[model samples]
Target: MSAPKVLVVLTSHDKLGDTGKPTGWYLSEFAHPYDVLNSASVSLTVASPRGGLSPVDPSSIDAAKDDSISTNFINSPSTKPLFEQTLPLSDFVGNPSAIAPFAAIFFPGGHGPMFDLATDPQSQQLIREFWDAGKVVAAVCHGPAALVNVKLADGSHLLKGRKVTGFTNEEEDMVQLSKFMPFMLEDKLKEAVGPEGAFEKAPSAWGEKVVVDAEGRLITGQNPASATGVGKAILKAISS
Candidate 1:
């Protein structure tokens, strides 16, 4: 078999909910996973809702400039082209035959996905197709926002009966943007999964927590710290 490939979807929205301040995918949220997945010999295609130039959430890096992954993702020449030339979401639309070839699709979190991916029809269908095809679907932090609106073939929300985790309401409040977000990530996830679906959380804010469905196809990470963990989980899923 050919080497497995994973599609890493980033958010194109640049504003943090009407705050008029800029926001986008958190650098480490993508970088950590990129680093891990790359180390495992997995190829990746980076894409965004509108494509080209996935914005950097400045706050995510401003404080973590010294972090190894954050530093490399922001300044390393090796990574420059990937972020600058992101493909448009259209590249993956209307082609299940094409989408089916991917072993998995991942959404890296930031405030931005809550604005775009949650409602983007292409994103929703791409996820549904990947899930229906029995391929893996993964997301991290606010990235799980992408799955909140995805409905399975049975017309039930994909998250309706699955266990998952993401940025918690407590974490949002800790960031003091609880009111700034369009909606609480935790609350919305709980509602999407319905009463039977479970939303587990990390013991502490910014802790690393990843949730992979029993079958190993549906994966989620709790926050930025969970990136690498999620990446490893994806590898294990596809490797099986």
Candidate 2:
């Protein structure tokens, strides 16, 4: 059998909401997961909403210096090119054959996704197609924002009655970015999942947390720290 193929989606939005601050995909969130999965021999494809260069959150760059994997990912010749030009999400939408090669879809966050991916209609449809195909759907940090408005064919929210986790309200407040985000991730996820679905978090803010609703074909990570775990979880899910 061939290695599992995964589609890694990044945010194209670069400006923070009204803050005039530059923000894009978080380095650790993308790099750590990419390293984990790629090292495991999984075939990966990187894509975004705009089909071109995806920006990197400037703040994450300095922070990621402490993480060797993330640092190498940014400077390495082999991996840095992945973000230079990403396949647009539209390429897979309405084209079942286009999406057929991937076994899972992943979204890595840096507050950028909370803006574009959260509201992109093409993204919603692509996710629905993946879900409807029983493929693994995963996200980390604010990436879960993409799922807030996704609905199944039966007209019910995709997150309904599912247990998931993402950037928590507390973490947002701690980072002092709560005011800048269009909507709090934790609140929106809780609302999207409804009462039947559970929104969990780590014991402390910024702690690593990875939620795997394998039966639901869903996986999520709480923050950048959870990226590696999320990738590992995806590998396990697909291999199983």
Candidate 3:
């Protein structure tokens, strides 16, 4: 059995709220998953909407305040290379054939994704290609917002009836970023799919809640805390 090919996508935006403070991808979001997949020697590639050394939230590196995985990844030499060598968005503007070689795709998030990823038609198209090929598509935090407008070949919403998880409206309020976020991700899902929609979230923001909807190969995480869990689930689905 060969190691799996994994593509890890990060965000390039660098501001949250009106503070004008730099905020890019959450370190935990990339660190946790990278550690998990790295353990198995998975071939990983980091890409972004604009790419070129995607910014990482400086706060995520605070040793005393981060999860173990986050701390470990920042301490690892191999994983750290991703932060230094991310591929540019223009590299895959037209659904490049290179993406199809990967076994799975993951979108890591921070407030940055809320600015660009959620509405990128090109990125969504890349996601659609991976899905249509029956590959795993995993996202954590606001990364799931990228699926908001994705449509299948049949013209149905990709997440229409999928029991997935992502950054919840409640958690957004907990972080006090609800207003700064382009749109309420949870509310948008509910509004798009209605009461019977399969969207679900964890009971607590810190609790890991990763859902793998039976309908499609969609996997989601509620927030930064759930990134590892979401990554594990993605690997499990692929290795199964």
C-alpha RMSD values across all candidates: 1.2, 0.9, 2.1
The CA-based lDDT of model 2 is what?
0.92
Candidate 1 structure quality by residue, lDDT tens digits, 96-165 = 7778668999999989999999999999988888887899999999999999989977898898878999
Report every candidate's CA lDDT.
0.89, 0.92, 0.77
In model 2, the runs with Cα more than 4 Å from the true position are 214-216
Taking all chains together, each candidate's TM-score versus the true structure is: 0.96, 0.98, 0.90
What lDDT tens digits, residue by residue, belong to model 2 across residues 14-69? 99989899999999988988888899899889889998899999899999787889
In candidate 3, what residue range of length 10 has the lowest lDDT sum? 59-68
Better of 2 and 3 by TM-score: 2
Model 1, CA-based lDDT: 0.89
Worst 10 residues of 1 by lDDT: 92-101
Backbone clashes for every candidate come to 0, 0, 0
Candidate number achieving the greatest lDDT relative to the actual structure: 2
